[model samples]
Every structure is written in structure tokens, then in C-alpha cells.
Target: MNRELQPLLDEWAREAGVPGASVGILHDGEESLLTTGVSSVDTGQAVEPGTLFMIGSTSKTFTAAAVLALVEDGVLDLDEPVAKYLPELRLADPVARDTITTRHLLTHSAGFLGDVDIASGWGSDALAAAAARFDELPQVFGVGEVFSYSNSGFLLAGRVAEVVSGLGYEDLVRERLLEPLDMTDSWFLPWDVLTRPHAVGHVLRDGKSEVAHDIGLTRSLNPGGGLWSTAADQLRWARFLLTGQAKDAPPLSDATRALWRTPQRAAACPIEQIALGWMVTRHGDAEIVRHGGNVSNLQLSDFITVPAENFAVTVLTNGVGGGVLGPKVVDWCLENLAGLPALEAKPVVPTDPAEYAGSFPTGDLGFEFTVRDGGLWARMVATDGTIETPPAFEVAFVAEDVVARAADTRRPLARFLRDEHGEVSAVEFGLRTAQRERSRLTA
Candidate 1:
């Protein structure tokens, strides 16, 4: 372990207004722990490796694994229509229920919207009510057409797990995944574990510290973002993912494991496509599977594993600085401790500076592309050519185009589609949309 990295980690925790932060690294079958900051402003308890934090969407990987276990036991089939298991399931488009399969939900290709509106609270009934709304959502696209991050998709997967296993989603996960893995400190209900000394999330409101409440804990979303876990427990979970060495682990077949890690389709990724609940990318010759979580307040978390490298890293933070702090911390560890090169900040290059500059349309949105500072920047302009309230920027590159950061938290440009001529034909501005040729304008 590099002791010198402690001060740099501490500095980020403080700068991010994190009440607490913990990082776990697994390399060559060994582990390293680092923590800093107080767990809460009120209690003043020092954050430690065992301090629990909301892991948010990273919980989906566990849910997906459990579902795969059932599949291995012949309790379910991935390609079969989801309606076969949950007959009551419905979408505004009746055909979707029949056409979309369990696989679609797992891969987030069902096109369901992310969340359902509900009263802010916790209870079984609230969860049931939210899950019941699945009958009303319109399909945004045909099943398996494109990838869009859909929280409701995973909720439905959880619901299917409940129906097929004859158990609640939380109970099934607890029995099959958590208990077998010995993740005793982790649970779906942090509120129930309130007696334990756990980090209380907070938010800065009007320069006053306010307690952060659980945002989406209804039964429906439990499979999506409801898991709470300590850094130590998360490290255990990370090891399971890195090595697939769970005692009495849910029966995930080798074939199923391969499919889970394989990229399903080219979704709207800024860098790489997504698989099941994991983010898929290549780092040199190794494939990386990772996921990130945000519980909406000052609670953020991320987990990354490189199976080929036998390495994994987890970053959990209690402050909500737009959720970048955790990822940045993880990146730092990968660079410094693991001896990997720092991820190069996206560089702007244009294959053809003139052809790259143009006006393009994305559904109802219009944008103007311009070149500046040896790079490219885009501004969303109204139909009448008025600048949108928040503008977008990008660093143009011939092969790996980089989207510059935007003030309103838009993703930096890191995507491009090539033309038949092998020139940059289309530019993708992060996970949002892609713009193709309009009229080439001079820089």
C-alpha cells in the first residue's frame, strides 16, 4: 500500500464535502483499505472501513446474479418473454409485454422510464404501489432496439425474481446472495438497521447541513438502488465479482457468467457499451466490468473489476458533489497504487475540421457545431438560433473525439461514428444523442 496516497485521498474527501469516504482495492489476491472524514456531522463518529454507505445502482449486479442463478436451476429462461413469468406485467404498448423478454430488462433495452413518482417514505405497500405502475408506462422504443438506462427495468427484473422464487426480492437476495457471501453488514433496508452506527447522509441547503433521506426505497425499486453496505462488505462483494468465489454462491453457470460480462450492444455510452448491470470497456488487453451508483444526495459509490487482471476497486462517499468524487478517487487509485497510467483526459481532435463543423438535429433538439482552440465545441441553439440556457462543448479528435465538460453536468464528448470514407461522420455528445451531417461549415 502506498502511504503517500493517504493525504491526497483526504484532500479530495474534504473538498467534496464528504461526511465520510472509504476505498477498497483488490490486486493480486491482496486487499488495501483507506478511509477518511467523519461519518456524520452530528455524531462525529470517525468513518472507518466498516462504515456503511448507500451503494445505489451497484445493487443491480447482485440482483442480476441472483436471477442468473435461478436460470441455471431451470427456474427461468433469459430469452423467454418476461410475460411468461409475470403475466400481470403490462406496458402502455400491449405488444411490449409479449415481445420484451427477461433479457431485455436485464440489459436495459426495454426502454421503460427510470422511476415512478411516489410519496417519500418506506413501506411494503409503497413499494407495491410503485411496482404496480409498470402497467402504465409507454415503451420508449421497441425491445432490443437501443440501450437506455432504465431503473424501472431492473425493478421489474426484481419483481420477476419474486414471482419465480416465491420470495420477496429482498429476501431472495439476502438468502441467495448476501448470506452466502457473508455480507452480513449489508442489507436492503438501512432504516431497519438504524440502530447500528451508520453514516447519515447530508446535503448542504442554504449553507445549512440537512439530513439526507432515502430517496427511492420502495419495494419496487429495491432491486435497483436500495442496497446499503459498508466498505468492508462491499470489498467482499467486489472480491466475489473479481474471482467468482462465493461459498454456496447462487448457481451461476460458467456460460451465464460469460454472457453477463460480455457487452450486449452498443448503447449510448460515451466510452463503451453496457452489459446487464455492469459497465463494459477495454483497458489495453483486459476487459473491465464496472458500475456506479448515486442515491441522489451526498451519497455516491462506484465499483470496478478487471477479471483478467485479478483486480477490483470500490469507492464510496457520503457527500454529493455531483457524484464525480467517488469515480475520481477510484481513478486515482488505479493510476497511482496499481501503477496504471492516468486515464488521459479526452483530447479534442477533428478528422476534417471543416466537415466536422455543421448544424445537426437530434429529435426535437438542434445544435450548432463550431471549432475553437484547435478543438470543437457545440451550442444548443433554438430553432430561431438563440443560445440554449446551458451550452455544450467538445474536444474534436479524429478517432477518439472528446466532449468537453459542460456547466450543467453534461458528459464530456467521447464518442464518434465513422463514415464510409472512414472520416468522422457523426459525433456523440456523451450518453445523450448523436449528431450526423447537416451542412459542413468552415471553422
Candidate 2:
């Protein structure tokens, strides 16, 4: 481990305003860990490499790999509709029900709402039930039309795995992925985490970094973002991904592993596109594949892999404020360590007289876009009421349909799409998408 990086890690944690955080870096298959801060304010126990952090949506990578493993075994078909495996599968739109396939789900083009607004502990049968209840949720886009991040899609994918393997989602992953990788300490349940040294999620309550009420994701969604792991285990996972090889690589073939890293959908933003479980993008000439996981107020984790340089970096923190720690560390590693130029955003270039006015609905959040200064401006509102929108910012054009609010560049990038009439139809705001609700603000 590069001990010299400790100070910077400590600084990043403090900036993120967390009790403690951990970072894992892997370059050329070598690993280093820099852990700082406390696991809990109540205990004041220093964070350790063994302490588990809930990795949130990064678990999608695990789930994706498991399904790919079945694909390799001739038990699953990537092109076939998920209903083929899970006979109970249904969605709100019958077209989506018939057209959406495993490929669409993996690529985030299945048209299912990103999330079903279902809480975590709906019981052991929760994911299966959630899959059956998709018909109750809205379909934001046509099948394969846009990339909308879908937690529900991954869960349904897990269900397909369950049907093919006759094993629970967590067990299938544990038996197939974890045991092979020799990750002894990682687990999908909070009960298992409690048996080991683990960190509770910290939240910013009234501008204070305090322990969060919920330490783990709802029990059923474990396949989506429920795994709790240490920095060391994450490094092991990164190393496996970096090499795309394992001792017994039956489940995920080399070709499928490469497919997991390859972009499956075209991007409307500055990024290249969304791969199965990774975000495939470019930083200068070097390709970067990464994913960030957030349990909203509880925890935020990030994993980045730069395959060209054989480099990977992961940041896991216990609170919302510390979300920036992962990418910042990534920028540092690539620039100073690898002699690579990290991606820097071009200055905000305001779009010309775009009619993004009025509101659009996503599963959870809605956006009210207005014409200001002859340019497009957007104020986002959370339907779940978890966040409050600040003053509107000018939506900057980084590409034809891709736009980003200058302040929050981490994504859920606004992608403006056009109809056959060549007019802006709807803008995809993150995973939750909405069409225009009105031309002018509701008076």
C-alpha cells in the first residue's frame, strides 16, 4: 500500500464530512488501501480494511456477472425476453412486456421505470413479487429507446437467475462469484455484516455527520445495491475485473466479461455509453469504466476501472456528503500515478433557444424546465421528497441531446430527445425520466 496517500484520503473524507471512509487502488494488478476516520461516531472505532461498507448499486456488477455465468452455461439467453425464464414477468405497458429482453435490461433500455418505489424489506420473495408488480409502474420510454438507469431491471434479472439456478439471488452470487474470488468477509445481509467489524451509514442531518437510521438496504433489493464489503474485498473484485480471468471462469466467459465492459447503448451525454454493469467513458484517449452507488442519505460507493492502464480505484464512504471522494481519488490516481490526463468538463456552453419549458415526470423526480435568458433552465423536484431543488441552473450542451447542470456533473445527465417532427419530446433526467408536463410553469 502507498502509505503516502493516507493524508490525501484523510483530507477527502473530512471534505465529504463523514465519520470515516476507505479507498482501494489497484494498478497493474497490485493493490493498495488507504482507510481513514471512524466507523461510527458513537463508538469512535477507527475504520479498518476489514470493516464492511454497503456498496449500494455497485452490486449490479455482481448480479450482472451471475447472469452472464448462466449464459455461459447455456441456461440463459441474453437476447430472449426475461419472461421466457420468469414466466410471471409483467410490466405496465404490454409492448414493453413483450419487447423488453435481457439485453435491454442489461443495457438500461428496457423502458421499465428505474425504481419501483418499493422499500427494502418486502421479505424473501420480495424481488420476485416486485417483478410481477412492474405492470403497476410507468414505462418512461419505448423499449431500447433511451438509457434510463433501472434498479428494478437488475432485480428482475436476478429473478431470472433464481429461476435458472434454483438458488436465491444472494446465494447464487455467494456460491458462484464470492467463493471463487475468495472474498471471505463480504455478505449480502446486514445480519452477516453485524457478525464482523462493519460501519454504519452516516447521514448529514441538519448539517451534521451522524449515524444513519438504516445501516443496510431493504433485504430484498440486495442484488441491486445490498452487498456489504471491505476495501480489500472490493480490490479483489477489481483485480478479477481488470484481468477478466478467474480460477474457474465457467459462469462468465471471457467474451461475456468483455461484453460486460463494452458499451451496450449509445450515450446522449459526454460519456461513451452505459455497459451492462459499468459506465464506459473516455478520459482523454484512455478508456474509463466506472460505476457510483448511492443509498441516498446512507452511503455512497464508487468503482472505476481503466483497462488500458490496468488500473482500478474504489471509494466507499458512510454518508451522502462524502460522495465526491471516489471520483476525486480516481482523478488523482490516473493523473499523478499513471501519467494519464483525466477528463475535464468543457466550460458550460448554453444551448440556443431550446424549448425545454414546463415539467416532465420520472418515476421519482420531476423537472420543471423554463426558458430563461433565451436558454434552457431546469429545477428538479424529488417526488419521493428526499431532496430540495436549489436555484435553477442553465442546462449546458455537451452534445446534441446531452446536457448537464453545471453544478452536478456526476450524472443523471439530462438527455433531450426529439420526435419524428424534429422537436424536443422529452429529456431523460438520470434513471427517472419525464415528458413535458406543461409549456409554462404552473401558475
Candidate 3:
């Protein structure tokens, strides 16, 4: 580990309003741990490498692993219609029941809105309540035609795991995934764990740190982003993700492992491509599998693995800023510690005043890109004509070719493809969903 980077990371924790931050790096098959700040501002305890923090959506890798395990046993089929397993499942659109398949669910192509709260409640009943509400959501688009990051889809997928494995969601993960990987300190607990010796979440209120509220327990979306873990345990999980095997771990087949990292669909994200539960990218010559998580004010986490490089990073924060804070730490470590290049800056071209004007529909998400001050700016308008600017990266030229850049990270815009006539022909935002170009509706 680079000793010089430690103080820099602490500076970031303070700037981001995170109470505590921890990072683990695996390089050349060796591991190093680093931590800074206090775990809880209330208790004044220094953050330790072993402190457990909520890992948010990074937990999806575990859920995806369990689903793949059932696939290996023929207990589940990735391509089968989800309705086959949960006969009671339905969407506001009756056709969606038949059209949405397990594959669609895994890839976020089912068109289900990400409305269900994962941080609602804890325990089996909370999971049941989330599962029972499948019929209420409208299909945002035809199944598999567009990608809308859907937490409900994963929640349903988790239900599928329970139905087939005959184990509760948490237990299935604990026994099948966590236990084998020896992630002994990791587990799903009630939201009150936020009040324990665990790190405290924080939000910057009026430029000062204020303890953030635990945004309730995730009852329905637990499968999507609800697990608390330490930097050490996350390192263990990251190692498994890198090697697809752990010592004394009941081994998964190479095929199953490969399936987990395969890109399923382009997510409706700004930066990386989305696989089933993982994000896939190339950091220089290395194949990187990664994911990040956030749950309002409570917790944030990120996990990244470079399989070919034999390197991995796990970051957890006690407060809300931990979400991006963790990734920043990872980016710093990769560039400084692992000798990876800092993310290359994309070329920025001044938009031609005339060419910069147009209204385009990105499936259900629509925005108008306009020329302003010799630069291109975009404003997303809702059906109600309310205008909002999504993170700047949400606006891009040529759809999929656009990239969104943040202070700590960069995400690619969903790409739009055009036909020879210069008419839009297809649209792909994330790796998961692509819609063919169709005739513009005449009003």
C-alpha cells in the first residue's frame, strides 16, 4: 500500500462528509487494508478496517450468485418466464406477465419501474410484502426493448431464489454464498444496526456534518442492495469475484462463474456496462467487474475487481457520501497503488450552433439537447413539462457514444444508432436494453 495515499483518503472522507471510510486492495495475490476517520461521530471511535458498513447494491452480486447456483442444479432456468416460477406474478400490463422472463429480470429489461423500496423493513414478511406487490407496477416499456434500472426485477429474482431453494432470501445468501466465502462478519440485520457500534451515516447539512437518518429498513428490495459488511469481508467477497473460487469454499463451475460476469444488458447508467449483477469494463488491459451502491442517507458502498490483473477493491462508508466516496478511494488506489492510468479525459468539442439543436426520445426517457454559449446543453422534460438536468453525463451526442463525467467517476451515455438516411434507427443506453428505431409518432 502507498503510505502517502492514506492522508489523501482521509481528506476525501472529511470533504465527502463520511464519518468513516475503509478500503481493501488486492494486488499480486496480496491484500492490504486502509481506513480513516471516525466510525461514529457520536461515539468518537476511530474507524477500523474491520468496521462493518452497509454495502448497498453491491449485495446484488450475492443474489445473482445464488440464482446462478439454482440454475446449475436445474432448479431454475435463466431463460424461463418468471411467471412459470411465481404463478402469482403480474404487472399492470397483462402481456408483461408472459413477456418478462428470468433473463429480462436479471438484465433489468423487464420494464418494471424501480419503485419498490429495498430499505423498507427487515425480515421475511418484508420480503413477502415486496413480492406480493408485483402486480401494481406498469411496464415502462415492452419487455427487453429498453433498459430501466429496476430494483423490483431483482426483488422478484430474489423471490425466485427463495421459491426454488426453499430458503428465505437472507438465509439462502448467508448459507450458500457468505458461509462458503468465509464472510463471517457479513449478514443482513435490522436497520437498527445503524445505531450500534457500526459507522454512523452523515449528510452535509448547511455545510456541517449532521447524523443522517436511517431511511428505514429495506423490506422489498433487499435482494437489490441491502447488506452490511466490513472492508475485510468485502475483500473476501472481492477475491471470490476475482477468482470465482475461495479456499475451502464449495466451488462453483467455471461456466457459472463466467455467466455472472457476462454483460446481460446495458443498464440505464451513465458510466459502465451492466452485467446481471455486475458492471463490466476495461481499465487499460484489464477486465474489470464492478458495482456501486447507495440507499438515500443511510449507507453507500462500492466493489471493483480486475480479474486479469489479480486486483480488487472494496470500499464502505458509514454515511451517505460513502457511495461516491468509496469509488473515489478505489479510483485513487487503482491509479496510484496498482499503476493503473487515471481515467482518460474524453474529448470535448464545441457544438455547432445549428447541429446542436434537437429533441430526441431515449425510449421512455426524453430530452432536448440545445446549443448554448457555443456548447451543447440538455434538459430532460417530464410528461408534465417539468424540466430537470440529470447529472451532466446524462446528456450525450449519438446516444451510446456519450459519456457522463462526475467529480469522482465517468459513465457513458446510452448510445443511439442511426440509419443511412440519418434517421435514428436504434437506441442503446446501457448494455442491457436496446430499442430499434421506429417511425416518429405523428401527432
Candidate 4:
């Protein structure tokens, strides 16, 4: 692995204003842990390898793993409709109500809202109550259609595990995945996190870092992105996912595990690629299963595994730029650490540059694609003037309708929806789909 990861991490932590970060790598049965920055910028205490940081949506993989374990035991069927397990659950749409299955939820094709921002007031029935309101969530696509990321789906899946096992979701995870794997430094509550050597999440404002109000995820949303864990524990989790390199036997069957790792196909028209609970992206001949989390854009985490090489990397940052840090670290690890063949970059001009250029508006904020030095560039603009965004990042077309930055590979970011005549009509950006406007606006 990168013997100089310390200096490289120091540079990134300084540049990104990260208060604290822990990086863990598991390669060919060996594990290494490293730390940089401080647990608290306010106190200036150095961060230790055991210090806990929120893993965000990366927690989704654990939720997925636990469900798969249940599947292995025949307690749950992958194709069985979720309503078979949780009868109280209801969707805004009836078709999706009775038809959506465990498969849909894990793959994020349940066709409901990507996020439900409402939280219960800390009751034992918090997850259940929040799930009941799921019927109020709007449908973005039909069941098994588009691959919109859904926290509500996983939360519902967690409730299913609770109902089937007659155990709390937290406890179910503990018994099934944590205890068996021996991850003692992990936590699921803000209070528990505060009691340990923990890092507080930070948001940047006016060129300064400030503590985030939502330090940890709510109890109701625990299944989605609520877990806080050390980098060491995270690497162990990654090691388990890389079964060949795993220290212990996998908790799920090889067939079931292989099924979960494969990229899922969208039900409706063609859509972007997302594995059951992770992202399966191609880097030449190698396939990467990775997941990233954003805890209110405060704490950012990413876990990635390259199965062929028995390699994995987990990163958690208590800062705003956690979104950008993961790709940089993973690319370095894959190429420099694992010695994987790096995909060479090629310069290609779009057949019709204006076809890819337009005003893609999402509510009040939008993106404007323009030519910069004859290269395609995407810029973020505040249409209503409420917030100021950074300057545009240079994005180049890497494939048909796909774009990539030097540090970014997920592209089309949102697939560009087409009109009847094949002109770009709308663009899907995760949960927020924006329309193509006639003229572009600037901040």
C-alpha cells in the first residue's frame, strides 16, 4: 500500500479543511490503519486510529449484508414483496404498494422518494412510524424503473428485518454482522458516539469550518446512514465483502453474495448502474463495488473493494469535501497500491457540442454546460441567488452521454432524459430531476 499515505493524507486534509480523517486498507489478508488531522478542530486534539467517525450511507452495505444473511437462512426471499413481511407499510401508489419486492428496495428501484427528511421524536416505534408516512412520498418512477438512491427504501428494509427477526434493527445488525465479525468500536447513536473518542462533523461557511447541527443521523434513519465506526472496523467490513481475502468465512452463501455484487438492471427504460446496495463501476477489466455517504454533507465516508486483487479502502472525513476525497484516494489505491491497470484518458470532441450544452435547472439551482478552451465544462449556478457555489469543474465526455472529471468517474451524474425528437429534455440528478431551459442563467 501507499507507504507515503501519511504525507498524501496530510496534504489532502489541509487542502479540504478536514478536521479529522481515518483511512483503512485491507490487501491480501493484511490490514493497515492510518489517521490524519484532529478529532476536533476546536480542541486541536490529535485523532487516534480508534476514534469514531460517521460512515454515512456506507452503512447501507451493512444493512444490505444483514438482509442477505437473512436471505441465506430463508427467513426472507429476495423476490418476495416487502408487504409480505411488513403489512403495515404502504406506498403512495398502489401498484408499487403491493408489487415492490425486497429486490426493489435493495436496488433502489422502489420508485418512491429518495429521502424523507422527517424524523420521529425518539420512540421505539420511530422507524415504523416514519415508514408509515412512506405512503406520503412521491413516486419518481414506476417500480423497478429508475435507480434513484433511496434512504427510505433501506429504512423500510431495516424495518422488515426487525419484523421478521422480532429484533430491533440495530440489534439485528449487531448479532448478525458486528458480533460475528468482531467490530467493537462501532456506534449507532450520537450519545454513544460522544462518549468515545469521536470526531465532530464540520460544514464550511464563509471560508471557516463550523460544527454541523446534525452531528449524527437520527434513530429513525439509522439503517440508511446512521452508523459511526473507526477506520479499522470499516476495513474489516471491507475485508468481509472481499470474501476471498476474508479472515472469516462469509456469512452469506457464495451465490447470494455474488448476486448482491452484480450491477442491477433498471426496470423501465435504460438507467444508470447501481448494484444492490453498492455501486458497480468498471475500470478497464476490473470491477469496483463501492459506496459513499454524506451525513448532511458534514461527515463523508466511502468504502471500495476490488475483489480480484483482494483489495479494499475505507475513508471517513469530518469535513465538507468528503464527497471529493473518496475518488482521489480510491483511484490512487487501485492504480498505485493494487497495481491495477489504469485506464488512459483520451480527448474526444462531442459530435454536436451544443447538444450537450444547455441550462439544466433543478428547482432554484441549476447547471450550465459550456465550452472552456474547447472542452466541455459544467458549472453550478444559483438561479434564485440564495447561495453561492464554487466555480465550474472541468468535465469531459468520456463515453456516450457520460462525463468525467479528473477526480470523478460517475457520469452522466444524472442521465439526460430525451424528448420525442431525441433532443435533450430533462436531466436526472439523483432525486432531483431538472428540466432543460432555453437560456442559461448565471450567479
Please tell me which predicted candidate would have the highest TM-score against the true structure: 2
Clashes of each: 11, 7, 31, 0
Task: Give the per-residue lDDT digits (tens) of candidate 4, residues 296-367.
Answer: 667888888888888888888988677666656777777888888776665543644566678876434566
- lDDT by residue (1-443, candidate 3, tens digit) is 64876887889887877878888778888888888888777678898876777787787888888998888888998888888888887578888888778778777778866534533355576766677777767666788877666667888899989998899998899888888888887867654455445776666556566665554335566788778788888888877777765756554677788878888765654545578788787777766888877655466777888776778888877775674577678888788767788876455433243333455543334545455544455444332322222333224343233434322124455454556987555444333233342333211
Could you estimate the TM-score for every candidate?
0.80, 0.88, 0.82, 0.86
TM match of model 4 to true structure: 0.86
Native-to-model Cα distance after best TM-score fit, residue 197 in candidate 3, in Å: 3.3
Worst lDDT run of 10 residues, candidate 4, spans 265-274
Cα RMSDs, all models: 6.0, 3.2, 5.2, 3.8
TM-score for predicted model 3 compared with the true structure? 0.82
- For each candidate in the order shown, give its overall lDDT on alpha carbons: 0.69, 0.76, 0.69, 0.75
Question: Any runs in candidate 1 off by more than 4 Å, and if so which?
Answer: 115-121, 125-128, 206-210, 214-217, 249-251, 349-402, 406-443
- Candidate 2 lDDT score at position 205: 62
Model 4 misplacement above 4 A? 244-250, 266-272, 348-394, 406-414, 428-443
Candidate 2 Cα outliers beyond 4 Å, as residue runs: 1-4, 120-122, 245-251, 268-270, 350-358, 367-380, 386-413, 418-424, 431-433, 439-443
* Candidate 4 Cα RMSD (Å): 3.8
lDDT of 1 by residue, 1-443 (tens): 64876787788777766767888888778888888887787778888877787888898898898898788879999999988987776678788878888788888788655444333346654445565677667565677876656677888888788889888778888888888888888877756557665676677666545556644345466788878888778878877776666667434656777777778777664547777677787655556788868665557788888776678888887766525567677667666655666555444344544556776544324456777765566765444322112334554453444445533223344455576888666555534344465566545
Write model 2 residue lDDT over 41-126, tens digit each, in one string. 88999999888888888899898889888888889899998778877777788878878888887777788677645663546776
Residue 38 lDDT (model 1)? 78
